[model samples]
Target: MAIDVRIPTILRSYTGGSKAVSGTGDTLADLLTNLDGAHPGLRGRLVTPEGGLHRFVNIYVNDEDVRFLGSLEAKLNDGDTVTILPAVAGGALGFAAAHALRG
Candidate 1:
């Protein structure tokens, strides 16, 4: 089944700057495998060496967080849109806000 994968800007390098790509897999894990085949190094960024989702990466299938669904084993169907986003936080603005709050 063909699945649509939305690529985050930080990981666009792996997709040759494409914001989105397509692949085939029955499960999320299988989709990653297929995507990595077309775009080498992509899977490594999403999946840890121990075969689990990376701590800072968040995946959503059909607008639902995969963590609550079954993680890598989450079943996928045709035409599902998968969005991959890196958990973003901890910038200078946050630090400054914390300092202001303390004062």
Candidate 2:
């Protein structure tokens, strides 16, 4: 299946600065492999050495979190949109904002 993947800003270098790329696969893993083929070193940042999705990375299939849909095994279809995002934690004002919200 042909899929459109949305690449995160940090990983855009692998894609020649393109924020989106096209790949073909039946599952998310295959799609990523295909992407890596065209954009070398891209998959290594998303998948771990154990062949699993990286802990700090998040993937979504058609707007639904892949973690809730079989993760890397999540099935794909033509025209499906795959989104990759790195899990972000505290920001510049995170601590203060969190404390303010807690009060």
The lDDT per prediction is 0.95, 0.92
Q: TM-score of each candidate?
A: 0.86, 0.85
Candidate 1 lDDT for residue 94? 72
Error of 2 at 69 (Å): 0.7
Candidate 1 Cα RMSD after full superposition onto the native fold (Å): 5.0
- TM-score, predicted candidate 1 vs. hidden true structure: 0.86
List candidate 1 stretches off by more than 4 Å: 91-103
lDDT of 1 by residue, 3-51 (tens): 9999999999999999999999999999999999999999999999999
Best by TM-score: 1
What RMSD does model 2 have?
5.1
Candidate 2 contains a number of clashing pairs equal to 0
